[model samples]
Target chain A: MLEISGLVSGYGRISILHGIDLRVEKGELVALVGVNGAGKTTLMKTIAGLIRPTAGRIAFEGSEIAGEGAERAVAAGIALVPEGRMVFPRMTVWENLMLGGVHPRARPYREATLERIFDLFPRLAERRDQKAATMSGGEQQMLVIGRGLMAQPKLLILDEPSLGLSPLLVQETYGALRKLNADGLTILLAEQNVKLSLAVSNRGYVIENGKIVLTGASSDLARDPATRKAYLGRL
Target chain B: MSAEVLLQATVQGLQMGAIYALIALSMTLIFSVGGLLNFAHGDFMALAMYGALALYQSFALDAYAAAPLLFFGFFLLGFLMFRRLVQPVLAAGVLAGAQLTLGLVFVQENFLLMVFGGDYLSVPTVLSNKNLVIPPLTMPWPLLVGSLLAVVLAAILYVVLMRTDFGRQVRAITQNSDAAALMGIRIDRVQAIAFGIGIGLLGLTGAIIVAQFTLTPAMGLDFTLIALIVMVIGGLGSFAGSMIAGAIIGVSESLGSLLYGGTVGAMIPYAILVLVLLFRPHGLMGEH
Candidate 1:
């Protein structure tokens, strides 16, 4: 489980995330939906410790982890599959995965975790020795997700996993997310793809201008008149 | 020119080239990993040489025996420098980092000048003036031994970069620092070690070459320039490229001196560097 409250963070002096309050229960997939520049990435980064929060608390399983930095966050069992599919371009898929398991907590389970990841993304297994940069975009996306799993994380945070992906690849990615949640993994996914995200998540929050504008069960938010009008493009 | 003379020149060039390669490799490592130009790199080598000189003067230890001590001492000094100075400016930009290191050049040069004065100094080991003769070719022991040790150090460095977990982390950081952090790597720790190793290598270079060359307080700038030329010619971050480029510069300089004159030979590396930049800017082994 993870809890965040009044989390204010940004690049330098300009605050992008202002007083965000969010939470995800154990074994739940929570979607943070927002348009471009709506502070979704900022909130995720703050939780993952890539950006130090200027205000508020981030509690991962009851211990405060605010501003602990990315290394400590990963050691505390949080793995972030960052936006833009930032795989080490020069490294092979196996090398990327091996690095993903470099955390001490994950190192002991690296072999086992790698096998599970390979099972989840067989394309990665087939291209184990291939450089990540040479792989197709969809395959790179799979590699990043598989890399996150290699960390054996208690909480997996993903930022824009479906961005730049083809529709078919997007569906496949969402399906993988669904499967991951079904396997009792807790996930925090930030996305602009409202329809697919709501469909896959148990609970969802609509963020706008660095504020949470709506929160409810996935189905309820999907059908809500305002949510439908703004996000789903329907009434 | 006779064939024997040509062969001798080539051999001598290669021996010097080996040493240049080590210096260039150190520069490349720091640049690739820490993202700093490390203008103080050559000064660090000069400081290492002085450390060896001091050791030799005090305990009558040969430069060869003082090498391990210099290597580890410089490593620690480099590590501390990164933590205290380099890391802070790293996020500011390349210019900021370069300026910080450039400042270090003055500090180190001044410190050495005050302690040792401006006189040229050399360490006299047993092998200082000795030469190994074989038929028509004779190799000075200092140059021969220095080149061999340089190659051995380079091989050890290669193994460390290719085989170790730290090496993997280093490569990971070089490719993508953000992604590396997401993978749980302590970026600062890895970078500090890398900076240390980069400067620490100069320790080995300094100790080995102390007997081969005379040291002046201002000689650090020349080595820095040579390293910069070598790094550029070899490609910015390629390890193999630096070694090969170092050899190319050394051989050309050696042959240039033999055929033309000392002035022209000194200018040869610059000519080659310009040609490399004009024709293949990325370097021989660099990725586009």
Candidate 2:
């Protein structure tokens, strides 16, 4: 459902992603894995239109949307659960979700979307009125993902949803994400959670220093000698 | 001052307090949401006053009839100008945004001078300034009308900000712009609407001001300074703060005039703001 070709982006004058290509078909989950500063987050941000691309072509459902702003990206049915669980801290959990459905892209499906989010994360419904900041790290991450779901995005780009969570929490989070994928949501999972991401993602790309050094099927990339050495720590 | 004069002064203070609240509320909304202490806020109010004067002069629309159009028109101006001009500079930093708004004030005032030739014009008052004398308490018609309008508008704004979907989005953006955007709450559109709404509120305040006081382009800085003091004392981004601070400022100035003189009364707001900052820098009700 989404395709990014030769994507190049960065903060003003400091180029990060030189030229990278990635894609996700409808109802598929693709994981982009990299170590620290791998430019995975930057790639996701560029695709979501948070950062303007110096050079790239991002096509979502057959339309170019590379340099459009975040609002437009959401309107085009793409949602980015930004890095670090950037929930509106002062807002209630329900309000955050409500805001997610505010985009024109999700307007038609808001009621059903809310039901889906609540169904997937029942904890959210219980704490709907609670301020997002007051929630635990794992809950906040879920809230962020649930908010992305609220957009009824055709492609959901989750940037490091497992960061800072305990191993058990990460397991639970990934479990929920798996169910979401099974339910037919196309996802771009950007993370350093190499094992979990590779396990769930249909296809995988290994990025380092703003370039994708390797791309292959998740199983092949997982067992590749270089991938094992650098990412899986199996060497 | 006698009992009657003192009572009259109190009434006048309350009336002035209402106008101050309206102006401060507009200032608070813009400063909080736009993330800039736009000194040009008062200029927009002046622009609305000019708009009203022009309409009154050309179409002979009374102040009441002209109010709605003035509100919507200046709101549109604020919305467009913020999107096209202010938002870009705001991305640079708060200081850059302040400079951009200051420049805007200069351009707007000069435009007013160029078009209107630096003259003072008043909106037609629908009623004579006849005082209702109640022996101990006398109320002017303009003050009564202005106070009524201010109270009604504030209540309406309270609902709009606290009880509506649009308001929820605004509060979200005000708290965290990046987070809001991630949730698909369009930051640019929300800010544009906020600027427009903020200025629309200011336009109404301007109409009220022209009803009771004479307006000049240069008075913008002075009026803005007072509104800034109110916002600061009330707390940045706190609507309740601005409202309470408005009344406090009004009373302090009134009492100061009675105790000292007009100059000391005028100076008290600045003095109180300094004291408030020294104690509670965030404001009476502002978030840290």
Candidate 3:
């Protein structure tokens, strides 16, 4: 469970995410969709504690985590699969997953969690010894997600899960997300693919210009006139 | 010259090569882990030399006996220097860190000068005057000991870097700091430890140097230049390159001395560096 209110963050001296608010309930997959540069990735990074928020109240299970660094956020059961699928390029797929579960609390259960990740991404198990950098884009994406799962995160935030993938891979990725959520994992899914994200998510939010423009049930938001006009490209 | 004289020269060159490799390895490790050129590397070796000397004077411990303590103390100093000074300037680029370290070198050398004066100090070794003569080579026991220690230290470092969890994190950060940080590694902490290890190797080099050579504050700059030459010829961040370069430079300098005049022999390594750079600009083993 995560709650964020009035979060603002950006690079040095330039604000990317203006005042924004969003939430994800326990064991729910919440979709945050928008166009490019819509502050979706910025919001995920802010929640993951990779960027220092200028003003925010980010609470994960009643503890404030807005300004805590990335390592601490991970230790407190938050794992972020960043945009661009930034897996450790030179490391083996297995080593990347092992590194993902390096926090003190996660270390004990690492072996079991690794087995789970391998099961979820069967292709990764076959190529565990190979370098992540050498893998194809779709396989690399799966490994990135599997690496995130190795952390045993209470909240796994997926950023642009379908970017740069083929339609088949996108369907496979979203199907994997559906199965993950069905297994009672909380996810904050950020996507540019509006139809696919809303189809799988129970609740959804539209972000634009670093601010949340609308928030509602996925079914309602998908059919809403303004949401349809701006995101779905329907007249 | 007799066959024995030539053998002695060969043994001496090998001994010196081993020490040079150790010092060059320190530079290589720092560059790879911190992405900085560490111009103050030889100065840190000089600092360890002085630190060892001070400890020896007060406690009368032999150089070998004083190594563990010296390495630990230098590691702490290195960690503090990286955290307090190097890391801040690191963001500006490698040049900034190098300049800061270069300035630190002058400050350190001057501080040693103020305390110990400009006179050369030698550690009185049990093997100082002893030699073991084979059929062709008259080998000094101290050179043997120093070279053996260098090999042992290199082996230990290889093991630590290749077979540990910390090593994985270190290697990851060396390749890409941002990706490692996202995977829950504390980059600052790992980098601090790396800086400590780099200086700790230098401390070992200083201890070995005390066994064979005299020490003085002004010697740091000369040694720093030699280490830089080795790093550049071998490749900026390649350990294997540094070791091979060190040995090549060492043997060539000796052979040069034998064939040509003393000054020309000394210049041979620098000349070889130009040749190597012409062929491989990044370094013989460096990644572009």
Candidate 4:
């Protein structure tokens, strides 16, 4: 339900993404994996419309969404759980979730959506009144995902959701994303955790520098000689 | 201090602090939501004074009628100013936006001077020279009304911020604009409304000021300074912080006047601001 072609974007005076092509079909959990500074975050941001692309097209369900403002992008059914888990630190855990579904389209089903989110993260329900800043990193990571879900998105894009989590917490996060995918949610996750990402994704792509270097079924890519050597750390 | 004297001073302090609290709250709202420090905030208060004067001369409306007019008027002006003056400079960075707003203060001051002239003018509201006497203490109508309104308005604002969906969107924008946008909040729309409310509050404070103080084109600077100091003492973006800090400044200033002299009292809030910055750099109640 999403496509990007010839997507060129960058910070001022320096281009990071050079003609990168990517796609995600309905109900699929796609992983974009690469090492540090591989422009993974930049690509995710470009798709989410936080950063405007200098050139190329990003289409969601056939309509070009390139250059759309972040708000319009969300309205068009794209929600991004940005890197660093940007929760409203001063606001309550529940308040953070409330903000997620503050949009007009999401408002109608906010109660049901909220109940579902609470069911997914019971820990959040317990800490509903507590300030988000006080929550642990793992909890905040979950909060960001739950907040993204609050937007009632068609395509949820997360940038390095497991970046700083402990190994166990990372596993839990990946497991939750797996369940959400099985519930028929489409997801685009960017990560430097190559092995874990490949393990969870239906399809995977390896990015180097700013371009997609490889793509295939998760199992096929995980076994490929180049992918294994470069990403999986198994020569 | 004698009980009666102390009570009198406390009342006066609270009265003065209420005005500062309104201005500081206005400043904080914009800072939190748009991430913009509007230097012209007090100038907008000055504009509201002029607006009130013009409205009164035109329609002879009382405080009730004037409040809404001042609010809607300044909100519209703020909306336009954000779109035209603030937005372009915002692209350059926060400092650029600040500088542009800073420059606007002098522009407004000069405009007011050109129209109203430099003479200090006392606003004659319907409540002029009125007071409530309780033995040795008499509460001037303006101070009593201004403070009462400040408290009531603040309570209303707190309710809106904590309870309403629009308020939630606003707070979301304040807490994290980018994330709010990702949740489908139009940052531009949110920022515009926020800037409007911030400046609108400042303008309404001007309405309150006319009930209490004489006006001149240069009066904006003093209000701006007080608001800045109060916002700092209250912590940058904390509403309760502003109120408590405002009370501290106001009471200190009043008590100083009683103990030392008028000049000394005038200097007290500044001294307290420095001390607070030194000891409690985050502000009396600021979060970060």
What are the iRMS values of all candidates?
0.7, 1.4, 1.3, 1.0
TM-scores, each model vs. reference: 0.96, 0.92, 0.94, 0.95
Candidate 1 lDDT tens digits, A69-173: 998899889999999999999888998999999888898998999988888888999999999999999999999999999888999999999999999999989
Best by DockQ: 1
lDDT of 4 at A62: 90
* Model 3 TM-score, all chains together: 0.94
lDDT of 4 by residue, B82-162 (tens): 888788888899999889888989999999999888998767887889999998898998888889889888878788878
Docking class of 1: high
lDDT of 2 by residue, A89-129 (tens): 87799888888887776767878888888888899999989
Ranking by TM-score: 1, 4, 3, 2
Ranking of all candidate structures by their lDDT, best first:
1, 4, 2, 3
Give candidate 3 misplaced runs (Cα > 4 Å): B1-11, B91-93
lDDT, candidate 4, A1-235, per-residue tens: 9999999998986889988999999999999998888899999988988889999999999998998878778888999999999998888988899888888888888889999989888889999999999999999999999999999999999899998999999988898899899999999999888888888999998999999999999889888989888978841
Decide which is better by TM-score, 1 or 3.
Answer: 1
DockQ of each: 0.82, 0.56, 0.58, 0.79
DockQ of 1: 0.82
Encode model 2's per-residue lDDT on B99-178: one tens digit a residue. 98899889989988888887776677684366667777777777788877887888788788877788888888887787
> Model 4, which residues run further than 4 Å from truth?
B1-3
Q: Which candidate is the best by lDDT?
A: 1
Better model by lDDT, 2 or 4? 4
C-alpha lDDT of residue A106 in model 1: 91
